[model samples]
Target: MLWVKSLHIIFVVAWFAGLFYLPRIFVNLAMETEAASRQRLLLMARKLFRFMTLLAVPAIVFGLWLFLGYGIGKGPGQGWMHAKLALVLVLIGYHHGCGVLLRKFERGVNTRSHVFYRWFNELPVLVLAAVVILVVVKPF
Candidate 1:
């Protein structure tokens, strides 16, 4: 069980690292104005997004297993587990949003700006931080 928990934590960290970095790549990609440059950026973004998605699956599965197998209940009112769950949902939304954006990019849409991506990138970081705090500190 402890090994499972450790693996879960490691995978979650790996997933978060990818999540945080992919958006930064998006920010740069959005800045490219030339067609060739944009295409290159799109390719990179696609690969990175795919990688992140792959990482996310195991992290989520392991996390669910940890939560269920370890008997860690959803936190009580105003509890840390509740906060973590909320942030996890937000992360899920962020992941889905990335998928939407990736699909749009693949379709040759060129509407998103670097500024937009930069701001968007901050969201996952914030949510990940909240999750880490909730898990580590268990603050209520």
Candidate 2:
């Protein structure tokens, strides 16, 4: 169980690294005027998105293992677990949304400005903070 927890933490951190930076890449993509730079950023975004998805799969599996197999938060007084799970789902949606944004960029159809991406980049940080608080503090 401890090993599973450790692995979950590792993969989650790895995934979050991508989540944190992909939008910054979008910020660059939105602002980039040079075709070469745009293509380069697109390549980087594609690779990172794929890698992050790989990391996310294991993280989610390990999380389910802890919750379902180990019963880490199955019983009463576990509202925090539910909250964390909700936020995790939100993160997953955000990850998919990043892919959608990347596709738009690939098609040269991106409409949002760099400023929108700058604000968008803050979402994961806020969600991460909330999740950490829910896990560590469990202040239900």
Candidate 3:
């Protein structure tokens, strides 16, 4: 169980590392004007999207092992766990959204400004905070 928990934390951190940086890459990608630089950024973002996406699978799997298998938050007064799960779902949606935007960037069809991506980049921070607080404090 301890090993599972440790692995869960490791993968979650790995996944969030990508979640945090991918949009920053988008910010740079949006701001970049040189054709060669844009292509380079495109390649970086594509590979990162793939790598980080692969990380998410183990992260989610370990998380499920902790939640459903270990029952970390299944007892009474676990409403906070429910909220945490909801946030996780939203975070997953955000991940998918990043992929969609990444595809747009790949095709040179991005519509949003760098500023929009800068703001978008802050989203996972908020989600991470809420999730950590819910897990650590269990504040329902």
lDDT of each: 0.79, 0.97, 0.94
Q: TM-scores across all candidates?
A: 0.89, 0.99, 0.97
| Candidate 1 off by > 4 Å | 74-78
When summed lDDT is taken over every stretch of 10 residues in candidate 1, the lowest stretch is: 70-79
Encode model 1's per-residue lDDT on 64-137: one tens digit a residue: 88778776745354477766777888888888888888787778684978899889888877787777777787
- Residue-level lDDT for 135 in candidate 1: 79
lDDT by residue for model 2 over 1-140, one digit each (tens)?
A: 89999999999999999999999999999999999988899999999999999999999999999999999977889999999999999999999999999999999999999999999999999999999999999887
Please state every model's RMSD to the true fold in angstroms.
Answer: 1.9, 0.5, 0.7
Q: Against the true structure, whose lDDT is highest?
A: 2
Residue 22 accuracy (lDDT) in model 3: 96
The residue-level lDDT of candidate 2 at 91 comes to 100
Note the residue pairs that clash in candidate 1: none
